[model samples]
Target: MSKAEKTRQLIIEKTADVFNSKGYAATSLSDITKITGLTKGSIYGNFDDKEEVVIAAFKFNAKRLRDSMDAAISKEETAYEQLMAMLNFYKTTWKKAASQGGCPMLNAATEADDHLLFLRDAVKDNFIAWQKKVSTIIEKGKAEGSFKVHLQTETYAYTFIMLIEGGILLSRTLNQITHLNTALDRVKLIIDQEIVN
Candidate 1:
């Protein structure tokens, strides 16, 4: 990468965790500069402003997570295995997620509700993409005769997101990973009793 590009990436990588942990609205330009060890002019040289950096940082955080999930899911060949691969990834997600201050999408959603209006669209797109990702997996399962033909892909997908996000919230809030585990448990039951043929 070019020097400018590398600098921009450094800024994003360094600030992603702070933005995710401290919150989008709560994080300031000074925080970005501090974490990245870049001057204000240098940061603004790479990004338009704090809003632009927040968006970039959020995408960085989200991509890191999606890449990890993709890596785990890719190892499995069958649809059932693929779906289980996803669940298993989440089953142990609390550790990495907690260290980063919870799921990036969930964190962005909560913060964007009213505070960070600029991020509303970006956050919405991430969620829609996520819902679609899960739905696509369910569709693949159906095509392979592993999942029920009568199943509602979007519904299950949405529920999957809801359960997982809810679990993350409860787990983070209560400081107990079991809350997330219980939610994932329901997810497994749904896969077996509802989706599977």
Candidate 2:
């Protein structure tokens, strides 16, 4: 990468957690410079404004979480197992997530829903992508006779995403795993009773 690109990336990496924790509206340019140790000129040299930095930071944070989920899902053999792995991912990574300021998508969606169109759209796209991934797995399971459910794959996919995101929100807010665990338990029960043959 070019020097400028590298510097921009460095800024994003350094400020991603701050953005995730404090949020876009609340995080100022000063916070960015303080966290990144970059002068205002250096930060503005890379990003046009705080919005750009916030967007970059959101993308960086989201990618980290997505990569972790993908890696865990990759280790499972069956489609059902893969879905379970995806669910278990949050459970396994919750502590790290809590430390990093909760799920980036959830944080962005909550904070930017009505204010930041770009970020709102980005979060929407992320949810759509996640739903599609789950639906694809369900379709594969159905095709392979692994799942014998008589339901809309999209519906199940949406439900799963909701449960997981809700679980994470409640868990993070309450500082307890029980909320997430209960959500996962519901997911498991649904998989066992409704999806699995």
Best by lDDT: 1
Tens digits of per-residue lDDT, candidate 1, 78-163, equal 77888788888987777888987889999998988878888888888888888888888888998998889988889999998899
User: In angstroms, how far off is 12's CA in candidate 1?
Assistant: 0.7
Candidate 2 TM-score versus the reference: 0.95
Q: Each model's C-alpha lDDT?
A: 0.89, 0.88
Worst 10 residues of 2 by lDDT: 114-123
Highest TM-score among the candidates is held by which one?
Answer: 1
- Residue pairs clashing in model 2 are none
Q: Ten-residue segment with the worst summed lDDT in candidate 1?
A: 91-100
TM-score of each: 0.96, 0.95
Q: After superposition, how far is residue 175 of candidate 1 from its true place, in Å?
A: 0.4
Model 1 clash pairs are none
Indicate the residue-level lDDT of 51 in model 2: 79
For all the candidates, what are their Cα RMSDs to the real structure?
1.1, 1.3
lDDT of 2: 0.88
